[model samples]
Target: MTTDASSSFPFCPERWLSKGIWKEREIPAATTATATKKKKKTETKKTTTTTMTTGRALEAFDEGVAAAAAGDERARRRARRALVRACEEEERRIGREEERIERRRDREEAEEEAAAAAADVAVVRAREIAVANREAAVERRKEVVTEREDAVAVEMAALHQEQMAAGGEEQSRGEEE
Candidate 1:
């Protein structure tokens, strides 16, 4: 018996398959066509994704920059509004303080006027009292003078009556002698 080098290793099928060891001589036609279509579709999808990714990255970067600029503008507006509010509040406070001072000044003036009026009334009352005291003293002096005049008139009438009676007695004695 003589054996070739390939037939000596029966477990290995690489030489036997090439020589039509199986019943089917080639792979199925349908299977080959389906595999080719699947490979082409996978390659097309990868190429499209790679080409479009750059455009999408640029659009996203532009949007981020715009958003940052808008935020900065809004922050500036907020700071400006805060400063304006602070100035307005300070002006209102000063106005209120000025009004308060004006009211205090007016009150002080009113009090001073009232005090002056009261002093004037007190002076008038004191003058009236002095005048009344002078009138009362004059009345007392008039009453004393009238009483002395009445006493002197009564004494003069009594002396005249006594002198007339003494003259009548002296005439009667001369006629009897």
Candidate 2:
């Protein structure tokens, strides 16, 4: 919603500025509005609208004092309603801003939590992978050790068999001699 910087004639000089957003503003000395001006020219009704400066629109009490120029009951009611509307509008705006901030905060918090969870999962996976690699290395070492022991046992057995055959042949030859 928007409002004119200056009120129309008869209410203009009151200089009440009604705005919704809260902020610092500079009230100008006077505000202008276009009003209908009539001129009778030889039985012809000539009408023209001209812009004129009426009153200084004050930055403060814009809603309550807008109708200040009229010291009447209707003007007072209008002013009251204007002030109330302004207040309600401001409240709505503040509420919307707060909701927006809350949503942003919630989104950020969720994202941070998700990131932390992902990091934790990654760390767990890395550890599991490391453990798996270590286990695999251990199995390879066991296989290598078992193969070496088997090979050594076979070599010793063959050497013992050779010695027995040589001893038996020597005894026979000696007996023959």
TM-score of 1: 0.46
Reference-based lDDT, each prediction: 0.51, 0.58
Q: Count the backbone clashes (under 3 Å) in each candidate.
A: 0, 2
Screening candidate 2 with a backbone cut-off below 3 angstroms (N, C-alpha, C), the clashing residue pairs are 15-57, 17-62
Candidate 2 — worst ten consecutive residues by lDDT sum?
50-59
Query: Model 2: residues >4 Å from true position, as ranges?
Result: 1-21, 24-60, 66-70
lDDT (Cα, tens digit) per residue for candidate 1, span 40-127? 5633221112212223322332333444356665544443344334334434655887999999999999999999999988999999
Top candidate (TM-score): 2
Considering summed lDDT, which 10 consecutive residues are worst modelled in model 1?
A: 44-53
Which residue pairs show collisions in model 1? none
Highest lDDT: give the candidate number: 2
lDDT of 2 at 76: 54
- Model 2 C-alpha RMSD vs. true structure (Å) is 15.6
Give the local distance difference test score of model 1: 0.51
